[model samples]
Target: MNAARGGGSVENGIANFAPLAATVFLALVMLLPVGTGVANVMMPHFVLIATFYWLLRRPVLMPYGACAAIGFLLDLWLDVPLGLNMLMLLSTRLFILSQIKYLRGQTRLVQWLVFALFTLILYTLSWFAVALAKRDWLPVEPLFTQWLVTTLSYAPVALVIGRLRRVMV
Candidate 1:
C-alpha cells in the first residue's frame, strides 16, 4: 500500500507539472505571431501580463530564469529589440513582487488600482522604448488604446486564475 501510494504521488507530480509547461509554451506561442510575414496589428502583451500574475502568485515556480527565458522568446518571436522585453519584464517583476504583500486577500479595488498603475507604466515604457528602437515617429494613441484594453482585461483574467486555483486546491 505504501509503494502504491508513493507511485501515485509521483504520477500526480508529473501530471501537475504538465500544465505549467503548457503555460510557458503557450506564452511563447503567443509572441510568435508578430514575427511571421503576415501583416499583424499590435496587441497588448498577454504573455507579459500572465507571466506577471504567475510570478507574483507563485514566485518559486516563475523565477527570474523563467521570466528571462520568456523575455528572450518574446524578443525573438516579436522582433522587438534585443533586451527590451527582458529589461521590461525584469523591472516589472521586481515591482510586482514587491507588492505581493498588499495583494494577498486584498479588495478588488486594490487589485485594480495596482494593476492599473502597473499597466500604465508598462505601456508607457514600452511605447518610449519602441519609439526609440524602431525610430518611428508614431503617436501614442494606439498605445493608450492597448493599455486600456489590457488593463480592462487583466484583472478578470487574474481573478479567474485565482478561482481556478481555489477549485483545484
Candidate 2:
C-alpha cells in the first residue's frame, strides 16, 4: 500500500474501485426510473448529483473531461442529443467549482440544500435554453420533477457519501 499525503493510503487492489464504482453508478443512475409520476417518469438526473459530489470532494477525480465523457456516454446510452448532457455537465462543474468556496466545511444539511438549489438552477437554465431554441416546453416539467427526485435522493446518498469522504478522497 502506498500512502497518499496527509495519512491516506489504499491497497493497490482497491485503487481500481473508484472509477469502476463511478462507471457503475453512472450506469445505474441512467437506467433507474425517476418514479411513477405519470407526467414525469424516467427522469433520474444522477449525473448532476454525482457531479455535485465530485465537484465538492474529488475535483481531481471527476474533471471536466470526465464529465464530458460521462455526458457523451449518457447521450449514447439514453438517446438524447449529443453534447446536451455534456454541455450541462461542463457548465455544472464550472458552476460548482466557482462556488466551491461556499461549500467547504458546511453542515450536511446546508450542503444538501445548496446542491438542491443549484440543481434547480441548472435544470431551469437547461430547460430555458432548449425551450428557446426548440420552441418546446416538454423538458421543463421533467426538469422540475427530476430536481425534486434527485434532491430527495441526494439527502441519503450524500449522508453515506459524507461518511465516506475521508476514505474516498
Give each model's whole-structure lDDT: 0.70, 0.71
Off by over 4 Å in 2: 1-20, 32-43, 163-169
Indicate the residue-level lDDT of 25 in model 2: 81
Give the best candidate by lDDT: 2
User: Model 1, 22: alpha-carbon shift in Å?
Assistant: 5.3
Best by TM-score: 2
Q: What are the TM-scores, per candidate, against the unseen true structure? A: 0.75, 0.76
Off by over 4 Å in 1: 1-8, 15-22, 25-42, 167-169
**What TM-score number comes out for model 1?**
0.75
Candidate 2 local distance difference test against the native? 0.71
Task: Encode model 1's per-residue lDDT on 6-84: one tens digit a residue.
Answer: 5556555554443356446556646554534576555556666676666666666666776777778778877878887
